[model samples]
Target chain A: MEIFDILLTASFWAAAVRIASPLIFATLGELICERAGVLNLGIEGIMVIGAFSGWMAVYLGAPLWAGVGVAMLAGMLFGLLHATLTVPFGLSQHVVGLGVTLLASAVAYFAYRLSLPEVTSPPKIVPFQPVEIPGLSQIPLIGPAFFNQTPLTYLAFVLIAVVSIVLYRTPLGLALRAAGENPASVEAQGLSVTAIRMGAVIVGSGLMAVGGAFLTMSAFSSFFFEMVNGRGWICIALVVFGAWRPGKAALGALLFAAFDALQVRLQQTPLGALVPYQVFLMVPYILSILALVLMSRRAEVPAALMVPFNKGER
Target chain B: MRLEPIPNPSALRSIGLPAGALVLTVIVASALALLAGANPFATLGLILKGAAGSKFALLETLNRATPLIFTGLAIAVAFRAKLWNIGAEAQLYAGAIVTALLGTGILPLPSALLIPVIALAAMLAGALILLGPVLLKTRLGVDEVVTTLLFNFIMLLFVSYLLEGPMKDPMGMGWPKSPALEKAARLPRIVDGLRLHWGFALALLSAVAVWVIQTRTTLGYEIRAVGLNAEAARFAGIPVGRVMVKTALLSGGLAALAGFSEVAGLKGNLTLDLSPGFGYTGIIVAMLALLNPLGVVVSAIFVAGVFVGADSMSRAAGVPTYIADILMATALLTMVLALKLTRTRIRWR
Candidate 1:
């Protein structure tokens, strides 16, 4: 059978969408942060904290969405730490973000060990299931792929519209974008650049946590170590690949996810027998680098990215 | 509030602020211990005892520190030039792969001669890995942080492929590990009958080497010039791009030496878990040391001691070992803040 035949299957597209859901949420989150002139490298560990706390909350008898809320709150708390240092304190975003990642990840592990001291295996919970839309489920392949997903997945799709609209059509969005591109201009307009950037990071981090919670609450039924597995970093690359635009970033997520899903399917075909599975796993990362190189020439990165802004100073 | 640079910071402000950061870290550590229902003082004591209270513990800490020193030096060298090479983890592994390949009965030489040849080869391999990302950054304007990070994932998968395929230890019972190094290829112990190897000695030598290079060379001046201001450095007739390329090779080679040392000196075989995020932790070490080459040695030992101490403390105290990681992260954050504060005064409007 031809390799292209795998792409025709409804199941393949379904897997692609399911995988893309988490990336969509995260890329959008990072997008928002970068749009506000802050690069939150804390995304990786924030996701881990989110995955653990969200699942831990659900395991302790909280409602599913409430578990997501717990995850978001946990992420925001870390985001607060990140913003306090990088935003107001005017510290290096790279160092502070890495520190937050380590701190958050360590907190998650410590919390996990303290919470469930006896469980040898990760306990399972009731994960989100496919909720089919009545009319769209009957359409062709795209319908089942896009419409019949968990509520979180649907929310992820909806957020792209929300973020794009708010970023483009709203005054708040203008100020936020101005903070990234020209903070002096933002300062001239009588808006607090720090507040805008901090709010963006905090809210954006909450969304990133939800993306992580999607992994445990929707993708898998249990939480485990390294389960997030650098997905957070991949989402960062997605932000660049999409040029920090919400709609384009989500598309980048989908494109990468499709390639990921394809690799999985490729591993089961005749080609699977010939090559090592590790090679296939390497493709997504290599492709991310390639995407960065391809789009970097035209990529409109936020001018004030990684630039610490101090009040009354350039 | 606004931060203004101080023309001359007093001695007390410099020392006191950094000391305050350490005190804050201790308080945080104690709080974490209390949360785990352990006696905070006892837990802290146990950590100290576990790290340096015994000769065995001290050696173990030194062993763990060997890799960190290399990676920390790697970061310090690159970061001093404002070149962010996050792929040190991958570069370290590249060095390890070279070590595994050359040391597994492939190279025919005396132990003394073979080690240097393998180290040089490993450094070259690691240097080449970083070269790609630096080139992409210089020419294509791709962000090296993301590209280097992406390279880490790619490199790990490549290592997994090798361990499971050509490098697989045939004598091992189906585990993914490389063949053991030949007796001639392994590093000799620093002292007879001691677990400590010559890698620790080599690390010290490298640190001093890096110190001399940074302080006494024209390349060093150019690196500092570029890091301070690229535009100014270019105007001063220093080749900014070429210096970055050279720095990349030096940094990547240093990071690769960690991998080489780990396989050839400590583990004697290459495995999937050769490093426990030594590359990432190196960032914390380098930052804590303020990117000083000599300071990297001190910070690497401190970071390694924390891990070793915390691991030992976990057995005695009800607290988890993650407290060490939290402490490290806290120290990194607080130290950077302290450093910033030392140079600048915060004034409230």
Candidate 2:
């Protein structure tokens, strides 16, 4: 069979959408946070915390929705810690973000080990299975890819539109953009820059935690050490690739997920015998770097991003 | 109450703040221990004893510290210039892979020549890994934080590929690691019958070397000016780009040295789990040392002691060793908090 024949299939597209669901959620979350002029590098750690919490909840016989709720709470709590450190205290964003990642992941790991020391194997929980939409599921090419997916995957797709609308059409969106571009100007307009940023981070982190919950509750059956596996960093890159736009970021996530799915499929073919799997795994990262280089000239990064805002200072 | 940044904090305050931060870290850690159903005081005592209980224990602490000091100095040198080299982990791996390739007698050279050659090759490999990010930042205006961080994932996967394939030890029982280094490539032990290697001395020397260069050199002045404000430094005739590149290269080289030390001093072979986030931990070490080169030695040792002690604590107290990681993270957070508190005047309005 031809390699192209194998690649162009409903199953491949379905896998891509499934894999890309988490990336979409993370990218959208990061997009919201960066639009408010704060770079939250703690996404990786937050996701790990979310995954652990969600898995533990399900293991303890809670409903899947409850597991997701607990994960969001965990993310919000960490987000609050980050905001307390960086927003109010004016601590370095990079330092606080990295510190939070370490702290959250450590706490999660400690909790996991302490709770289940005797479980020699990683404990399993019932995961989210795909649900097919009635009419759309019968379509030919894009049917299963778009219509058949886990509930979290559908939410992730819907959020793309939701985030785009919230970021473009709402008063809150205008304030968020202005805060990122010029906090002083926003403050002059009688809005609290810190409050807006804090809100952005909290909401953004909630979404990121949900993305993480998608990993344990939907994508995989159980939690493992470092299962977030640098996806958070990839999402951070995706935000840049998408030029801080929700629609563009979602597309970037899909593109990466497509490559990821292709790589997995490629590893099972005759071509896999010729090339190492690691080379294939590197496709998304290398492509992102190239894309960043190509787009850096035109990408409209928020001018005040990463700069600490002192409300009263000039 | 709120904080207002002071223009010039006093010398006494700088010294006092870190000590205060350490005390605060202990208190928080104790509170956490109490929650974990362990005696906080006993856990603290075990940590101290585990770190320096015996001659071998001290050596083990130093052994763990050897790589951290290198990575800490790596971060200090770069951060002094406000260049965040988050790819130290990748650069360390690069150095390790290169050193392993050279150390396994791929080149025909004398012991003295081969060891130095291995170190140099490792450093060059490490620096080259970071050089791409620096160039991308300078030319395309790419953010170094994300680019440097991405490189880490790439390098890790590359190393994993190597260990699993070409570099796998065939004679060993299915272990995914490179072949052990020859005696000539190994770093000599400092004391007889101890695991401590010459790498510890090298780490100390590098720290002092970094300190002198940072404080006493024209290049150091340029780097500092660039760090403070690149536009201002450029107006003053300093080549900000050149300083950034130089700082990046030195930072990468130092981080790579940490990888070289791990392979030559302790592991003697490149494994998948080599360094175990030593590069990331280096950031905390550098921060705890307030990004001062000289302070890195003390901070690395302290951080290393925490890790080693925690390992022993796990054995004795039935607590997971990762509790040490929590303490380190807490220490870093409190350190930053303390620095801010000390530098700011509190006011209630």
Candidate 3:
């Protein structure tokens, strides 16, 4: 139709892509972790840690890349703590993960408050700038949509591709998959199942942290309490919907992000104009339940998703 | 380390696991406190002083404990039936929504009648919220954890809608909260000026009621049996599905009481932040109590003391209130780990 109409549609899609980027990274990370037979329910907490660390890094003199680095490190530390609790200690994965989430949220809130003690107004940071590819910018709709995004968005797409290859195309991937499927069998073959799972957890947490950092450093510059909100849990649901596949999980994240973006855009529409905003806020959760119901039968989650592996067990 | 076969402990001895875990957690948590530039012993002293130091602080501690007792009992009852009810937070909100609706409405009744009716409405609201997951888990074989958790978000959104939409008071400025409940519908303060109200008594009474049902009643035995071993329980002619459904509903109802207490007893108005994660904290309480109803009261007060101490710690130590949250979480983590590590196996024929 008209140029303005085309621009509006493009802008909406762009916003959708931006919103979905962190989710895509986090879900893919969770997908890898789940495939390796660990349910990193601490994704929410790790994400919050990432959000805070990233914000702190940016608040200092660090660049956006530095913030991402710090976020990933923070995520790894959290993942290490979570893995130790559930893996060696054999504590309830759900309980430990939930605890981590609460602890991380508390840490983030306190850090934020400490950094901006005197300010009644919300603290702000400079968000990452979009980097446009030189030749790609010349293309029509595809150019703006794909090439013009923050570096993290580009990295997120690359990660999906990388994760897919690492999970299905390599010997390490095969061994990791086997470990998750039957730890006893893998252990008999002389592979350390605990080590493999711990590696997966750490890597997955790092990815989740990067996702959180993306939210703070790119999507939203300012950190608020509960900013990560329930996105981490949403990422867990995404892994289920994607059936623990990196590509599919990324798609699920994008779908959720698109719906979220549409909800925001629809707030300006006539139907949305009449409805209370909270109804739209419920869309992600409602869609998550619908996704679970529709996919439960077909979704082939890892057989030992939450089960603790004991080396001494036969 | 030498491999040795240690003597298997008696069941009575196994109960010491929680106590041992608490001591270990305190040690580890103390180390963390040192890293924060605070003395662990001093911090412990400060926490105790902050929680129980002043009359006002003690009253605040009781107020905090009031809702937690209900939530803890709610969690314990569900855990007894092997039902993991993570939606206590949502149920709490559901109860609060109903209490607000009924308490603010034009129901011409005496204060005595109005208050109990409003409380009952809250209980029903909370119970009704659990129906979906209970049905889904039993009928469709869906995981209650996912369904209950999802429903929590739905209920939260619903409450937000009510606060911003139909329940919004016209006389209020731009605050996103409902109109204050009628004076007749409010819970009477137990002591003249203290924030303590009849809800505290209700909390204590409910704790006793839960203990009676859990230990003395047949249903409680069935619930405990199902939790221990569902297949064996079913083989023993216990209605496992029915027990699950009932426990889930009861858990929601208990959690809802916390919401009722907040609205009618404390706030007299429904706000979005009515619960400061009371449902989640209830999980920690239930676990710490080892799922004992009476023990829930002790654990809840302990947890409430932490919250009160956290606020005071912020004021006294200049440490953020979140330090207390961190310490509490650390304690929970360590305690859970310790319990698992110290699991005493029983040799029985």
lDDT of each: 0.93, 0.88, 0.83
Which lDDT tens digits does candidate 3 get at residues B268-326?
99998999889989988888887898999998999999889877776766556777677
- By TM-score, the candidates rank as 1, 2, 3
How well is each residue in B164-230 modelled by candidate 1, as lDDT tens digits? 9999999979999999999998989999888899999999999999999999999999999999999
For each candidate, what TM-score against the reference? 0.99, 0.97, 0.93
Off by over 4 Å in 2: A1-3, B1-3, B8-17, B346-349
| Model 1 bad stretches (over 4 Å) | none
Model 3, which residues run further than 4 Å from truth?
Answer: A1-8, B1-7, B10-43, B235-237, B344-349
Task: For residues A1-314, write the lDDT of model 2, one tens digit per residue.
Answer: 64687567999999999989989988888888889999998888888888899889999999999999999899988988887788778888898889988998998898888888667779889899999999999897699898999999999999999999988999999999998999998989989888999888888888888889899999998988889988888898899989999998999889889888888888888878689888987777787777788788989999888887876777
Per-residue lDDT tens digits of candidate 2, residues B40-95? 99988898999999887888899999999999999998888888898899999999
- TM-score for chain A as predicted in candidate 1: 0.98
Indicate the residue-level lDDT of B174 in model 1.
95
DockQ for candidate 2, C-alpha atoms: 0.68
Query: Tens-digit lDDT track for model 3 on A1-314?
Result: 23235346767677778988999989988887888888877888889999999888888879878888999999999889888887766677877887887777777776766666667766778898899999996577767777889988999999989999998999889878887788888778888888888899899999999999888899988777778878887888788788878888889888888788777777777667789888889999888877777677788868888878876654
| Cα DockQ of the candidate 3 complex | 0.48
User: Each prediction's DockQ?
Assistant: 0.84, 0.68, 0.48
Candidate with maximal DockQ = 1
